[model samples]
Target: MTSAFIHLKASRLGRMAAACLAALALAVPAHAEKLPRLVLAGPAAAVSVPLIHMVETGALKEVADSVEFVTWKDPDQLRVLALGGKADFLAMPSNVAANLYNRGQPLKLLNISTWGVLWMVSRDKNLKTLADFRGKEIAMPFRADMPDIVFGLLAERLGMDPKKDFALRYVASPLDAMQLLITRRVDHALLAEPAVSMALRKTKSFPISVVAPDLYRSVDLQQEWGRLFKREARLPQAGITVLGKAMSNDALQAKVMAAYEKSLAWCQKNARQCGEMVAKRIDLLSPEAVADSLAASPLRHVSAAAAREELTFFFQQMLAKNPALVGGKLPDAGFYGNAGRP
Candidate 1:
């Protein structure tokens, strides 16, 4: 072939190769770098639902070579995970995130995904409000943490002392409180989502029905919070926090938040399927209950920066009740992650 013909051929081949590479890049996720692996941790709650979905669906495959979800059942376990730098991301209570951040843990709040999932389940259907059940025994979980802090503030707002107005039986976790309710050991219990739905579901199912008393999801604390606190009928209770190594990876953090938000939306829209998937991952929860929890929960994804106002309001409320609840003060702006567009 002549020199011009050869040059023309080479140019055509180069264009075709570039087009092929473009198609390949489009077909696969374009990541400049990927972490060898990532661990997403959370409790067996609604906030963690999307994390499990992300792992099962490989939602963060582009950002990391592998992503897995680990369950941290209680605050101690959550602390251990954070302190030990074992988890890259975590689904944690908003207050706990603030506490950790204030205490100098290298972590940042990514987004608040769990808006309102806490509820007061009771055997007494007549109990309509927080005050109505005064002077009665109620099982509470994670005393001085999240739902407890929220309960205390709400009770104080109503001019009723939490410890004096009601018999607050502190339990280790929501599931423990749930068990007490199901077994009729406690007439009322404060439970978060999935647990709340589980209690409602288990009470009616077969052998448990023989002994378990009929329960009612009576007092919605979020509603009570709004009514008494004069705000929206939702609280910034929980969100995902980027921990340890994940905090430094801004691109990965953004991608992770994007995947989490998309996963959360997917879980809400496809509750039944999401429930089954979550059920497989968390043995304590049932598919039916998970689906019900989704319907009942006011789950939303709000970026940390965008949610700062509401979160500050929440932290301020907690701070007023007990300074230790948020590690003695509101976290600096650095506590919030600049990830994912709200």
Candidate 2:
């Protein structure tokens, strides 16, 4: 009877061990099946239309288990989100990213979202070029924004002190800038796409030039940077990025690139529809403004190679101006995604 009882106890122990192993095997695969959550940070304005398109069209949703968008009225808020790691994905200016990265912020640029959509609109014909704005009042969105920064750089390049040569009126938003320009409250205003287009449309009486208008124009910001540095530095605009802490998995990175590509394609194919969606969401203008803005803005398509080249040029320029833009060190190969060489 003792031998039989011992045999039964040994058999029960063996069965329990096998069941535990099987349970672990099942749980491991279940955990692996879980998807990472993606969060994109940007403003609700036209600058982030592409990102909004990606979410609305389900491109990001198809890759990640969940995706969330955080909107900020100010660009500083977006920068704070990236710095705090509260955002997995973010759309921000290249200069802002460079400043943050230089400050030891761990984030990798994914792709360029838009470029060259800024316009210097002014009613005063005397303000034809950057050099003409001496002791003049200009309305701008915020001091931290790329447009403002670019204007500052332009002023510096033209031998004008940013603090004393020109006076800047900080408008609460892009819309406010447009209003200030239309009502002639401000001498000149720096405007971005859709807002620029909307201002032109609303004030049919005013004529606005496209700033440099030509790629080789003397006042071209990119060309000026290149001339100063004697390097092929292009203006780095806006882009999508991922926090380094959130990009631990190689597979997640690949999915992000794929989603951005898909989203870009979707926006290009449905440009009109996307514009209509934006029009409805912002409640600012007619569908025509949406369509015209997308048509006129050169941010519709970006090849992977072109995007990298643009970023590389931007970094080179920033380094020339201030080496501390990239954390007192230049970005190595790790700062970019593995799509292709720029």
Candidate 3:
């Protein structure tokens, strides 16, 4: 062939190849623009269970090359993970999420999955109400945080003082409170699951007798919340938040959230399987205890914006007692990720 003819054919082939490449690019989903790695962090509570499921199931494979789950034992560790930008997604208390957001953290709460996990476990079975435990030394965890704030709000509403009405024994973590219960060191304790379940299970085992110091799922804080606040028998407690760079990626955010919601439903349905999986990650928990906790806890997934009204009420209540609870004031509309959605 002549030189011009050969050059013309080469140019035509190049154009066709470029068109094919463009077509392939358009065919890929938006979430296909994957990140190198993604880190998810949370406490070993029910809120983090779904995240563990997502990682195990490779639910976010399309959004990231690798997905990891890290456990933060306390509020300080959680804050460390978030403040250091170590995690892209985190499971945290709703109020903490609000506090961080109000304090100008570049994070947005995606959904509230843990509604009511706080319960008052006591040795006295006859203890029917929060008022019934007057003057008792009750082991409490996360002193100024969750279960504490909820307890305070309820006590103050009932015209009782949290600090003066009851003897509150502050501890470092829920497990410490559970230990106090298991050892028969305290007659009462406010604990979140699966620590509650673990406590009940441990107390009934070998060395410990079933009758002497058997624990009861005494007054449920959620129940009191409903009766006193005239609201549902649940609280907008804990949920997942997307942070830093991930907040701007809408497609990835949607994928992460959809996976989380689906995983949460899966966990509730397959409690045994979920429990086993979660227990493997958190050595402090047992499969049976996790399963029991799931059954007892009012676990549900409500989008952050959908839960705003209830959250606003909760935040307002907290702000009343302690202005610093929610970082001085209510977080603006932007705090809720993907706001205005149904």
Q: What are the lDDT scores of the predictions, listed in order?
A: 0.90, 0.65, 0.89
Per-model C-alpha RMSD: 3.9, 6.2, 2.3
User: lDDT (0-100) at residue 309 of candidate 1?
Assistant: 96
- Per-residue lDDT tens digits for candidate 3, residues 265-342, read 898889999999998999989899988998988887788989999999999999888989999999999999872233
**Model 1 RMSD, rounded to 1 decimal:** 3.9
Model 3 Cα displacement at 114 (Å)?
A: 0.8
- Stronger candidate by lDDT (1 vs 2): 1
Model 3: CA > 4 A from native: 1-11, 20-32, 210-212, 339-342
Q: Which ten residues in a row have the lowest lDDT in candidate 3?
A: 204-213
Clashes of 2: 1
Distance from true location, Cα of 4 in model 3, Å = 8.0
Tell me, by TM-score, which candidate is best: 3
Candidate 2 clashes between residue pairs 3 or more apart in a chain or in different chains:
102-327
Ranking by TM-score: 3, 1, 2
Model 2 misplaced regions, further than 4 Å: 1-36, 44-47, 125-127, 204-234, 280-286, 300-313, 319-327, 339-342
Error of 2 at 47 (Å): 5.4
Put the candidates in lDDT order, highest first: 1, 3, 2
TM-score of structure candidate 1 = 0.90
Per-residue alpha-carbon lDDT of candidate 2 for residues 150-249, written as tens digits (9 for 90 to 100):
6776677777887788788887666778778766677577776677767766665324333222111113444455666475534557776778555675
lDDT of 1 by residue, 206-323 (tens): 8898898689999999999889978999998899998776777798888888888899999999999999999998888999999999999999889999999999999898788778
TM-score for each predicted model, relative to the true structure: 0.90, 0.74, 0.94
